[model samples]
Target chain A: MGALHEGHLSLIRMAAAENHRVVVSVYVNPTQFGVHEDLDSYPKTWETDCGMLKDLDKELAEDGNNLGGIAAVFAPTTDTMYPSGRPDQAVNAKGSFVTITPVGEVLEGASRPTFFRGVATVCMKLFNIVMPEKVYFGQKDVQQTVVIKKMVKDFCMNTEVVVGDTQRAPDGLALSSRNVYLGTRRRKVATVLSKILRVAEMSYLREHRLRDELLGPAEQLTKLLLMEQHQLPPEERVNFEIDYISLADPETMQELDEVDETRGAIISGAVKMLPVEVPQPGEDLGLSDGPPVRLIDNIILKPVKL
Target chain B: MGALHEGHLSLIRMAAAENHRVVVSVYVNPTQFGVHEDLDSYPKTWETDCGMLKDLDKELAEDGNNLGGIAAVFAPTTDTMYPSGRPDQAVNAKGSFVTITPVGEVLEGASRPTFFRGVATVCMKLFNIVMPEKVYFGQKDVQQTVVIKKMVKDFCMNTEVVVGDTQRAPDGLALSSRNVYLGTRRRKVATVLSKILRVAEMSYLREHRLRDELLGPAEQLTKLLLMEQHQLPPEERVNFEIDYISLADPETMQELDEVDETRGAIISGAVKMLPVEVPQPGEDLGLSDGPPVRLIDNIILKPVKL
Candidate 1:
């Protein structure tokens, strides 16, 4: 759970400013990962992450306003976490687990269906262990943040949940530890995810409903098709497959059929990029995944008042 | 959840002895009751219950051992408990709830299927609200006690669960608020429930397996049949029915085939009793259920050292 990226650091910064004590838990929880997903391969730069946290604490302390700093780093082992934690391993794991209804099975998206259960269970465990007054998350994982908020209310958990803004690179690719998995070929086209969301956001301001701008029978299908019109030319980047693009209710994560601006919405998408055959002139790419790199991104959609 | 019976008082006594600050929550959580179950009819003598608790405090304090008394009484209203509690009440009650797996559905008996879910959720709310260092439960509710113990460990909650002994009358009828539901005639036969368990215990002490003693082979079947033989004849008391007599694992609530003493077992039973037709001479039975009253009782089964 810790690469100590700016996105995560931003949440820590917000927690430091707002709370009396800031505690960070940096553990790559195994239960949250699927059998096929990146559990074994997930990032674990513990020493480096701790170092960055120390540096950030020092830098924030330099401001001399004397805000809260990291109080503790709870990094327990998988056995410790799962002593009675995982229900799936019922035979082996003796720990009891907490699960939310309907939401885990549906709202978390059909791909990683059990994802929220893992998240919810672990978060409950952490809340019980840490007994914190407030917990924090980044808005990049909007649906996760929403699910956790619901879980807290449903369980009557005594902790408040706060979401921080999504941090991004200058070129607009949302920063992610998974972004490191996007090798050169996919990395070259990584910004397309944000580009699509940007177009969807702009179209939302004019069209109001993203579904109208995207594929589907209803109003404004032409503008929707226009929004999907790839901004990058075929020669400019390798081909990539669009997994899905839809407007979703921020809280429920259910796809919005008739999108409205009353509570705003989220434009979420995923893309799978194929390996590049030829190197582009004057371009440098970091070594990452040579295989297809699947990346996801989303943006909150609301009309701006003049 | 309060009737101040001996079973409940024993738990209070234990909590008073062990904890630095003891707190008791007295809320008959509505979410745990089914629509048809005794939600409206469930006992609610708040004043009498509070008076008894005050007497308990006085009794404990006069010992002069100097320990904490009942720190607070969390008797929140139904609306407050389910403020965002009942997900099952998706439309009306909006409060979030917590739930555990396996135990609630099976251990609570198939009749009250949603019973454990309601119990688990409300207990989570209470745990979050009170944040007590330790909580006490009566062994009379064997499965509920087991479920809560697992929930605490699984959630990594920093609370210890302590179970108290089951309190019973001299004749062996378990003390319960529902015992009042038994009229003068039915109360005479109430001891039949414990008689069944005693026979089963003797069978287990001899046969080492409750399943064999209660049901199967021809030889043990006679003893097992005797176990089912009620002490009170039909003419002596109102008609009653045994719903089930099953041997189960203490923790998982799963039915046990072969008995083992290492972990012990639970011998649980339920009886559906008819109302007494005539008032017995001289004895007074408080008004209770006009219709049939279904009662349940259980005993822990362990091998006796010879």
Candidate 2:
């Protein structure tokens, strides 16, 4: 997970600000990806990532009294991390592995079934390896942050888990490593993800409608808005789809039947972008020369809004 | 896991002797048991466990330089540990939980499918809560000890998992919590578990037959030996049964297809003993007052003989 976007940098900056020492792990965990998922195509810019880390360290140390700096970077190979060998055929792996139970089955997990199991397992391994006093994560992956928090608490792990606010592009698209997948034209339109969620948030605040009832329509409306607002030609709009838009109780991650007066909610969604492709003479990029890349973004909607 | 026999005490003593402080957790973890297993009938002797611990500390302290003392006893309630709630229906439990995959599926795990998952998860939870420098386990539960070692190494847990030599009674029956289930008569025959394993270990050393070929007849020979050695009346022998007998790789917990002369093997077995009734006439002791208690024991057969 090492393409070092501002969102990840924010967590690093926060960790540097808060802790005396920091260690960042930069490995694309393989177990987390399904057989058909983007294990191969996912970004890997280790050199750039290290340069950014060095810059951030210099920047942090330069801030007068800001003393925290990265102590190390754990970049383990697949063989080193999974000594039982690759988890491709997990059932036969010789090592003892970690899994997060039911919490791994909702929302994001529903879309990517094995996602949190991989996240929780790797995080636990990282926590053990680094033995950190505190850990930080970006809030863009709200479900993932929550799942890690549960693992820390349930396991009684010593480190504190801190969630930093999600960083965003100038146009408001959540900063993500996958953002590289967006074509120049689609990248401009990527802001639609947060825009749609913000719209749902405003609607929930004004209407006080049950989340379940509201989110379903909000998802459908986002499609209409995409068509009308983008003013894209029919051919350009052909392969686009909104995977899911959900309003769920933040901690439990269960989709709320209705928003009560007290507890707030989290609005999350994933979208597949059909962007202008970089044409190759012989290659088909599957849906208009742009690989169908899934981008996820989320925002918290405080139910008792002031 | 609170029966606190010599096997458990040996581990506690080892932990105390080696580390600066020792904490013994006595909760009977519910997740590790199957619905039909003996979770309900499992023994809980908290007071006696504490008494033994206090006695061990005094014995260790009296020897004068054993600086490590009991700093805490983290006997958490089910609610305290699994804040996500009890793992009664683990699949849907809200809190994050841990699992040690494949290794949990070999050998003992093959018989008790969910057993090692429960063991790995709880041990991780305990490791987090205790944050120990070193952890200890009796070698009697060889498979459990092996699974935990894999977890510690794989996850990079900070603590060292030290395996203590298995402790036994004067008669050489491996001490276990379930031994309490044996009525006086069957308790006498309960030694059969270790007795059979001892014979197998000797046979393994004496004969170089392939493990799979040898173990099958070794098991059949144990039943014959049990009848001949005890010379039990046919009435008493009817209720006893051999659950499984295996020769396995100690590290992987995989049943060895054949033994390599460089690395030895572990001879393990479990036997269910149905003893004479506890003689409370009107009590209606459903399964004939003598509980069907399953006891497990094992021995390491080093290939290089003197």
What's the TM-score of every candidate structure? 0.83, 0.91
Tell the DockQ for candidate 1.
Answer: 0.41
Q: Write the per-residue lDDT of candidate 2 for residues B15-130, one digit (tens) a residue.
A: 77777888888889988887678887787778888888888878878866666877777788988877877776333344455556566776677778778778888898898888
The CA lDDT at B114 in model 1 is 59
Residues A210-239 of candidate 1: C-alpha lDDT, one tens digit per residue: 476642432243234335444545445566
Colliding pairs, model 2: none
Question: lDDT by residue for model 2 over A161-220, one digit each (tens)?
Answer: 898998988789988888777655567667777888887877776866686556765776
- The candidate maximizing TM-score is 2
Docking class of 1: acceptable
Which is the leading candidate under DockQ?
A: 2
Best by lDDT: 2
| Per-residue C-alpha lDDT of model 1 across residues B14-68, encoded as one tens digit per residue | 8877766778889887777766787768777789888988998888887667466
What DockQ, on C-alphas, does every prediction get?
0.41, 0.62
Candidate 2's TM-score: 0.91
Write down the RMSD of all candidates, one decimal each. Answer: 4.8, 3.5
